[model samples]
Each structure stands twice: as C-alpha cells, then as structure tokens.
Target: MDKLKKNEKWFWGGVVLIELILFYSSSMTYKQQTSVPFLEKYVHGKPLKSSLSQIHFNYGGKEQSIANDGYYHFVEFFIRKGAHFGTYLILAVFLCLALYTYFKKNHFLNVFVPWLMTTGLAAFDEFHQGLTGGRTPSVTDVILDSAGALTGALIVVIITYFVIRHKNVKKV
Candidate 1:
C-alpha cells in the first residue's frame, strides 16, 4: 500500500532469512567446532587439554573443537540445550511478526502461514544438517521447533482476544 508497509515486509523477511542462516551455522559440526578461541584458553599452551581435562576435539587443525569431555563438554551440552530453547523463541517471533503483517491486509491465512513456514524451516534445517560433516537430523529438534510455533500462535490469539474484549468493555 505505502512505502512504510512495503519496508515492513522487507524487514521481517530479513529477520527470517538471518534466523535461518544462524540456525544452520549453529548446528554444523566441522573440524573447527572446538578450536574456538575461548576454548583454546583451556589448553594452557600445549594446544591440548590438560591431563585432567577430558576434552574431545573433532578435527585437529588447531581449530574446530567438539567437546567430547571436560568443562568444554559441559559447555557444549548446555549450548545445545540453550539453542533449542532459543529456537522456540524464534518461532514465536516469526509467527507473531507474520500475523501482524497479515492483519494489516485482512489476510485470513496469516495465522496458519506462520506455523507452516516455521515447520518447513525447521525441516529444512534438519535436512541441511544431515548433509554437513558430522551432523545428523533429529526428529526431536523438529518437534520442539513446531511446539514453539504452536505456542506462539496460541499466545497471539489469546492476547488479541483479550485486547478486543477490553476495548469493547471500555466503550460500553
């Protein structure tokens, strides 16, 4: 309709695209997975874990470290956990943004479209991981992603319902 509205579409479109890129980047496991700079600090100077540190490095290029053990292992475990939780937040954001856009145009499918897109994106991410060096597709991740989308949809619907009701009450 106007420039502002058109720009809004582009803005949200970028958000979706960037999120996809981040999702893929975070899941991939390559040689340098553990050679993270901060991780290297743990090695103390030998370029290897201390005898007490039970670390697992995927590839030995002095980069790309996957934690097989030690504190690094703990970090890796928590990172995965955190990633899943963040995925839920992203799903919610995308669905909310999409519905907001659709509302401006009276698009009845807006709510449904977000869920469809979110799942499709999750499936794509899982599939992409399958092709990566050391990554496998997990049905669990997809389920979590979908669950996040569902939660987002329900939240928006509930919020909107209450807002409309409150407005009517005020008018009366």
Candidate 2:
C-alpha cells in the first residue's frame, strides 16, 4: 500500500484506540464519572424534585434521582443517552472509513461490517457498565447505540456515493 493509505489506516486505528480508552474511562464508579466539570456543579445539595410529578424513571428497579440543586434528571437522562449516541456515531464513521480503505468494493460490507462491529461494541459496553458498582446496563441503551452507528454509517454511504459519482462525472 502507498504511504497515504498507510497513514489513513493509522488514523482510523488511532480513533479506535481513543474509543477504547473512553470505554475504559466510563467503567469507573459513578462518583468518578460525575466528577467532571458540569456534573460537579450539581453533585450535592437538596433534592431537586419535591413532588413525584417532576418526572423520573427507575433503573434496575431503583428510582433515578433528579439531581440535587434542582437540575432535572429527565434532562440528564437524555443527555446521557445522547452521549452514547454521539460516541457510537463517531465509532461508526471511523469503522466505515477503515473498512472502505481495506476491503474490496462491496455495498454490503461497507454497511454491515461497521454496523456489526459497533453493535457488538455497544453490547460489550453495556456489559461492562453492568459490572461497574453503580451503573445499570440497559438494552434500550444498546438499541440507541446501534441506531446511532447505523445513522453514521448511512451518512458515510451517502457521502461516498456522491464523491464517487463526482469522480466518474469528471472522468466522462
């Protein structure tokens, strides 16, 4: 392979490594995970929701807390799920790029491989979370993660199709 090809592979490999590091970091205790900038701001004080009407759901049969200091847990829940989506989306992008660089031209491989890889990783991530002291693993999160990966892969497919079409047009 050419130098550029090698460099691209290295770039994708680095992305995967960074993702793994993130996965490991997420395996930390709830306290460790919440010690970050924005979360730290609402870590302590009185419970935010006084009435049951404020909105919250049970995780592992235990009611999730709306934060102290009046931060709505409903908002936090979506933010957390959104983070999962964003991370998997990035993972899918890199995975698709790497596969395109290395594999033969095949529409199925381009989509299926990345989707399978991402879904598997998401499952493993949930399993890891289950092992963590305060984290609860949810199949719903796995579905959300897979959907994100699929969306990312589809975006790449659309862009690649247009790029290839443009190249052919230039050749014509």
Candidate 3:
C-alpha cells in the first residue's frame, strides 16, 4: 500500500480507539467515574481551594460555584466538561484526517462530514449515558461536544489551507 493509504488507516484506527474509550466510559456509573478520590489523595493543599472559593456559576440547573459546591466538586465539574470537549475535538480531528482524501473534491463535505459524524457520536454517547446509573444525559453536553468537534474540523481545514497555499506559492 501507499503512504497515504497507511496514514488513512492509522487515522481511522485512532477514531475507533477514541470511540471505544467513549463507550467504556459511558458504560460506567457516575460513582465509578468520580475523580474526587484521586484528587483528594494526590492534590493535598488548601491554596487552590481557598483561592478559587469565590468563583461561582450555574450549570445543569444547579449552582456550581466553589462557594456552593465546595472546591473539589467545583474542580471536578470543569474536569468533566473539559474531558467532553477535548475528547470530541480529537474524535473530529481524526475523522477529518481519515475522510479528507475521500472528500477532497468537495472541501465543504470534507469538513461537514466529520463534524456531522462527531455530533452524531456525541448524541449517541449522551443517550448511552442516560442508561448508566447515576448519570443523566444533557443536551448542554451535546452542544459542547458539537462545538468542540467544529473547532477541531476548522483547525484541520485551516492547516490544510495554509499547506496548500504554501505549496502553490512554492510552485510559482
């Protein structure tokens, strides 16, 4: 096989691996997925807690400020949301890379297809979460995941644009 085919296979493999991770995590109950214990064990200190105590905001119909939920819960909230964002971002990036060659004739399809696939996956993930104990599916999470996917697809599009532009300039 050619180098491009090998790279495409690797990219698709990455997408599969990420999807498996999402599935495994979604299968676990909230109790099983909590990072609080790990944080409490390894990050011993009041400095972070005290400094962030004043920060507060509402999320998922509840107040998530450090003052309302304590430092650990507050921190955990961001960690979980960040994970959602980062995971979808990587998923979309991999999908884009994997689909790029196939959809190269249409730039719009190259970006749109990956974003749509990532969004569909995010929706499915949330639906899976609804079946898990102590876990509630949220539309808000799906939105966040979609946003992350869009960002990742845009990043690939931007990079490709620059690379192609540079090559054209070099040719001239």
**Model 1 steric clash pairs:** 31-64, 32-63, 32-64, 33-64, 33-65, 34-64, 34-65, 35-65
Q: What is the lDDT of residue 103 in candidate 1?
A: 64
Q: Global CA lDDT of candidate 3, please? A: 0.88
The full ranking of all candidates by TM-score, starting with the best, is: 3, 2, 1
Clash pairs detected, candidate 2: none
RMSD to true structure for each model, in Å: 8.0, 4.8, 2.0
- In candidate 2, residue 30 scores what lDDT? 74
| Preferred candidate (lDDT higher): 1 or 3 | 3
| Candidate 3: Cα lDDT at 156 | 84
| Candidate 1 lDDT over residue span 112-167, tens digit each | 66767777777887788788777767676777777776666566666655676797
* Candidate topping TM-score: 3
TM-score of predicted model 1?
0.59
lDDT of the candidates, in the order given: 0.60, 0.73, 0.88
Q: Arrange candidates by lDDT, descending.
A: 3, 2, 1
Which residue runs does candidate 2 get wrong by more than 4 Å?
Answer: 1-6, 35-70, 102-104
**Any idea how many clashes model 3 has?**
1
Question: Candidate 1: which stretches are off by over 4 Å?
Answer: 1-11, 23-27, 30-75, 101-112
**True lDDT of residue 94, candidate 2:** 78
Lowest summed lDDT window (length 10), candidate 1: 58-67
